[model samples]
Target chain A: MAHTPFERIWDRHVVKDYGDGRSLVFIDRHFLQEATSGRAFDRLRAENLPVRRPDLTVGTIDHSISTLPGRTLHSFAAGVARNVAMHKNCADFGVRLFSIDSPHHGIVHVAGPNLGFAIPGSTYVCGDSHTASCGGVGAWAWGIGTSEVMQVLATQSLILRKPRTMRATFNGRLSKGVYAKDMILALIGRYGIEAGVGHTVQYAGPAISALSVEGRMTVANMSIEFGARGGLVGADDTTFEYLHGRELAPKGAEWDRAVADWRRLYDLGDAMFDREIEIDCSTLGPQVSWGTTPQDVIGVNETIPDPSSIADPTRKAMTERAIDYVGLTPGTPIAGTPIDVAFIGSCTNGRLSDLEAAAAIAKGRKVAPHVKALVVPGAAHVKAAAEAAGLDKIFIEAGFEWREAGCSMCVAAGGDIVPPGQRSMSTSNRNFEGRQGPGSRTHLASPAMVAAAAIAGCIADVRTMMH
Target chain B: MEKFTVLTGVAAPIAMPNISTDLIAPSHFPGKKPEEAIVMSFKDKLFANLRYFPDGTPKPDFVLDSPRYQGARILLTGENFGCGSSRETAVWSLQEAGIACVIAPSFGDIFHDNSFQNGFLPLRVPADDIDRLTKGLARTNASELTVDLEKRELRVSGMAPIAFDLPDNRRIPLMEGLDQLRFMLRSADDIAAYENRASTERPWSFAAAGG
Candidate 1:
């Protein structure tokens, strides 16, 4: 029987079905970070079980490790003990770990794909919401809670209820300075935050086909923000090109065989979807979240929505509360909103291309005198590559701090938070109230948008600086 | 994990949508090591943003602060409660604060899974039922509500009981208090056979770490 790409992959991994909707799905790779894995590991020990497939599980310290250059684990303010616990637990369980000192250590989602652990037509699970980033390679990856993490560690499988499929096709061409971030933000802005609830979103169409693997990762990474189960972009020449010769990717004659199989993972023309959305990307501009949620977004040229004009009472209340917390006036243009900081990092936008794009804008320019700006690479290798390409030098000369790799400033748990009452233009995913700090307001945008905002000390359209 | 067949307690209502984990347990320790902090610190941080003023004094208008809802073991919240972040601390903080069950129209995926693993019931009922329960508990001035998982009904004073459905796989665990990992391990042979087949079919996945 013909099946969608998602069903083919999901069906291939199902170990056993319990007669209900639930099935024990095989996990190809299990990635772990310090913050979420400690409890799962502890629970495994409490049950007197070892990591069932230690060879397939890899641990790293991303969430609880400091991104300060030349910093040690002991220097991590809040995550020191947790980082220590991770090392101890991983060591005891014989799970391979990329420590803070390891050059490969970074965000689990970034490290997984960067190291080629995320193979096409496979499944990856992490106790992280951004695990969908691996879907850029046509893998079906999603986040699990600590308990599911424990279950996977104990049995190398997960009991999952199949989610309905939703196809979101982005057609036409993206405008100059618009990006995958803009594409997703615009989609979320049009469709409310809960648009993808109970569904796995398949991204296709001409616009998605044009995206680089890194860009696809950026789009897939934010699936959780809009409440999607996960997001997938099918593998093609671009996918294989990105995976070829990567550290953990297939090699030798096996590479040819792997490519042949991955080629068949594309969706059939008549693939069915429970729901579908077709987006025209031609008119989309640089999207920035105006309020707390990702759905509360507007184009760079647009104004904040007035609560009174909003039709939904719940959404209106949310808008009012967001305006109050963000200290923004309703109906005012968002472009000139003053910002105290600019951040370009996170699993979403911290890839090498993100750094290169931001650096291109930063070259021969300076950050606003009063504004603090930072550039944290998504992975240690990305930082090293940026340094080799002199992107780090460009950022530093522009007064943006080029830091080491980790999930810095994204989760705001590593002491990289913006000050209270200060506003920030960030390339990270979430913008919930106080997500960055106690009273810090976050405006989400692309790397170039963040760079432009840093230079202007206010939210600015990346298109204005594109040329 | 405590076996939960039934629970009776006052249900504090917070009818705000997208009540994220950050709000449930504000991630604001500010250089304080979480591993070093006392258990009470997590309890103190529960609902800190809405429950307290900037000076750390309890807010008078907060639902959890009301004397009538003191010791509430069930929470009646709006849609998408426990969204944002994969922090298990959100569930831990609520559990520490004596919330044994969360009744909502829906929940964030990870939070729903985390709640069950932590022995907390995250019951999903129809939106109308949730609204009716919230209004009924208020109108009747009912201090106690009963969640009968075995009967799949929520009983309150002077109101018709509302039925809720829990999938059998999840329901069985709650009734037996079985650890999910141990339960999963029961299918070890099937898992092994599947992996053996998968590795043969897709050997790239089992290649050496970073090759």
Candidate 2:
């Protein structure tokens, strides 16, 4: 039987096959940033481990560095030692660094794809949570721990345990205001956070088919929140169209050949998966995370769940804890709870479209006086696009703190944070307790909603605020 | 290099998805300094909101919260389990919480790698097997999972022998109790080999042959 191109890529990367169903996967493309690599590589040096394959790996400043397009990264500055240290560290490790001024500069997620470093059917790994975003291009990508960060740093390959296969199929057309974010959030609400543990899920269905490469990334980026090794989609025209003219995408005759090859990437008809889940996107509403976990969520129109309605002690305890931490009673609805801050940025939903969507709502509207609003672009490319479109001026005019790109508030780093005890509307993944900042409650929403909240200073319906 | 012992055991099921790092160790007010809860098992606390098929209906068949599935080491769950941001708290929470092996149809890509690195067995079982385990948990109340890190095979009794995708270089340490940090430290000879190769293959990489 002939294997698909995906399998071919898989076979090529298989460096060593261990008995008992394990194999050594040699990573061809390795991506890293200052925030994690700085510390991880330092540890590798402490252990005296020299990098095995410098040619196979690529390093850049993403998580902790800025996305100010065209700005030279000054090595000397106050409170910029970490950034300086990262440059020096990458130099010491012989890793090629894509610094701030590089046209290729952007968020790690955006930079990889924009530069065509992320190719079809390749295994991509990054030192960030949203690395699954690469799955948009048919690449198997995921995040790695700090220690594993050191491992990949020393050697381009990572030791991985094979994952069980699962097929999560969602069929149906999406309603307006309900994007890919809503589809995933609906799955979370239906399944909860722990529904898909120990599985490598392949998203297949009519709805998943209609999604763009960007949208597919939005879903794959959150696979970790669902607890899967990697989320993937079969290659199709959308994958090809996005790759066309892409910085790293093959060109001319090579592009035609690559497309022909990518067209054949699919699972066998008789191929069996470890698990299967099916969902319908037609009924999905705007999703919002009311509790700490992504799965502890509800549709925007729905009210916060009452823990008493849940008789299970374990679930009840979890709900109660979330309610207490979020300072809302279960019976009292999450809709009315006020928001103090609104953030729109992160590897997820920090693209040009997300910025534009937020900017549209920010225009002609003033952010509430009490609210601290921020619009952090995902990458330098996104920042440049937003600036060209004048979206930054809209955000800044509407009282949002327009700043440089980086992970920023998504992980509650570099001062893009929610104040203690304040609830924030964020356009990033994860809403765990203190995930944004110590004692700072977070409510996960779409970029549109983040803009609406920034204007209203509370969780107002983005659609309602549009007019 | 120090050798770490592999502690093998039966996989207790605490099946649920979207197990983020916060559930493992909440980004609480306290810092990373040693604390009682961090040192203690985080299973119960970690599986706080774990529910089965949350379509506003109840399915009393969950691994961590179920009485019948109690003490069963293997946790069977749906696909995309452990999806979301890359937070090691999820790994620490499960590893410390007493789940030696997590058997699911899928796993969060990053968390899957994190699990192997941390010395816990995160197994991938067929979807049918996952459903079967869930049913078995409800029927005979048995869902035993055995993970032999040395053998690198997960035995779920009724389920077929499933393969794990691990790197060859990583397999040695995992089976021999060498983690990433330890592997780097122990392979002093290998590091030297690469360094010596680097001097010639990419002369700019090294300032001088001997400095």
Candidate 3:
């Protein structure tokens, strides 16, 4: 009997199933970052246990790591402790450490796939919530707390409650300016934020198949923000093409065998899902978050939603609160909202394709004098690749700062923050109030939208700037 | 981890949906030292922005700042509470601030799991029940609530003890106050056997280093 893609991966990874809902699932790969791993490593040492599989684990300096040039551990006064702890712990445990100096170092979610560690048809985890980005390669990946991290580091397996499957099908072609970011933001906006909770979502259909593997990662990276534990797209020729020459990918006959196995993992047309939702991407435009949560979004041309227009009382109250925090009036068009900064990076939209898109819009254009624009690559390889492609020159010429790879400005933990009372158009996954800084307002958008906003010095429609 | 059989406290209603970890305990504090991160317990940073302003002055309008809910040990919240980032510090902060139980309609999966790991109770009550409790707490001057884990019920004044669901595996840990690692180690032999079989069945998945 054939199995759905999600079930096939789960069945293969289950070490012990008690004929019940819980199972001890085998973890194929484990990734860690500085902020959360320190405590887990401390717990393991306190218990006097060696890592069960060091070779399968990789540690990187992200989250609190600095993206500033010539950054040392001491350069960031507030981030140095975890930075030092992470280096010491990785060295002590024998896990492959991607130090700040290493070309492999970047955001764990991005570096894992770039180096081919996040392979197809396996279970992976990290102590960071965006670990779902690994699902782009058809891997079953999700976040865990430090306690679960300690368990996996010591035993190579975790007890998991079986998640109900929810498949989100995007059924039509995305418009010219509309991107994977827009599609995902639109989905979260249309459905409530908790729509995908307690479920592992399989993103399938013509639109998903059309997305490049990098595009799929952007969708999966934000799956947590949409309330899914994980989100995956079935492996296809597009996925195979992306992984064919990757560093840790299989070689020769092994590659052929792997492809054959991956092909079989695709869901059968009649495969069942506990719940299914379909979105028509054909009409979707470039979306922007007008309020605090990702779900409080509208198209670039649409006006801010009035509280009265929202029928759900809870949502109405939330909208009112968010508008007060964001300092926006009801019915104001989102396109003209003033912004002081534009950031083009994060695990969400920091991939090569994202850079290319932003660079295309930025060619021969300069950022407005009032906007502080930045472009931090997702990984060192991405930085090197972009430089080789001269995307760096394009961005610099456009007045955007081209920086080293790290989780910079996406959160305040990184020390690169948008100032208080200032608005920012960012390519990051979240738009929570004060998320960028104290009293800092954030609007989530695609990289192109960010670049366009940088040029215009406020929120601007990318469609108008394109071509 | 302290085993929690029952918890009775004055409940405060923070009825907004999607209250993220960043809000519960902010990741960034102005001019905070790197060494300070290790020394500052989550309790010091609990609702940093809401409880205090930039100059460290208390914010009067915030729920945690109100006199009525002072020392309130239970938080009643709306849907998708604890929605962003896997910061365990949020759980630690709530626990440190004397909040032992968090009742909501639903939660972000990681946050829910983290709460259990830290011996904090995060119960998922029905939306209507949550609404009733939030309104009831506001209506009454002194409102106390009780959460009984053994019976999986929430009791409030002038209302029925609303029943909630918890998987046996999750419940067992909280009831026994056992860390997940300690509990899993009880079946070491089975784990080893499963590993041996997994190595034989799926060798490719183990090849992370690329020999």
Over 4 Å off, model 2? A1-9, A43-50, A65-81, A267-271, B4-175, B179-211
**RMSD to true structure for each model, in Å:** 1.8, 9.1, 1.9
Tens digits of lDDT, candidate 1, A1-467: 45789988888889999887789888888998887888888888887888888878998988766778888887666788788999899899988998877778888888888888888888888988889999988888888887788888888888888988989999999978989999999888888778887888999989999999999999999888878858899999999899898877889898999888888878456888888898899988889998888888898999988999989887788889989988999888999999999999999999999998898889889999989999999988898899999998899999999888888787675778877678999999998866786667899999999999999889998778777
**Count of clashes, each model:** 0, 52, 0
lDDT of 1 at B122: 89
Displacement of residue A56 (Cα, Å) in model 2 is 3.2
Question: Which rank order by DockQ, best down to worst?
Answer: 3, 1, 2
What tens-digit string does per-residue lDDT give for candidate 2 at A242-347? 7788655566776676676566556445556667788888887677888877877877777888988999775787788788778877655556567888888887
Q: What is the CAPRI rating of model 2's predicted complex?
A: incorrect
- Candidate 2 lDDT tens digits, B1-211: 2222243343454444444554444432222221222243455335432331212233476455556545554556555556555666577666666665666766665666677677766667677666655554444334454555555555555566545554445556556656555543454454455455534532322221111
Residue A167's lDDT within candidate 2 is 77
Pick the lDDT winner: 3
Fnat for each predicted structure, in order: 0.41, 0.30, 0.55
Per-model chain B TM-scores are: 0.89, 0.60, 0.88
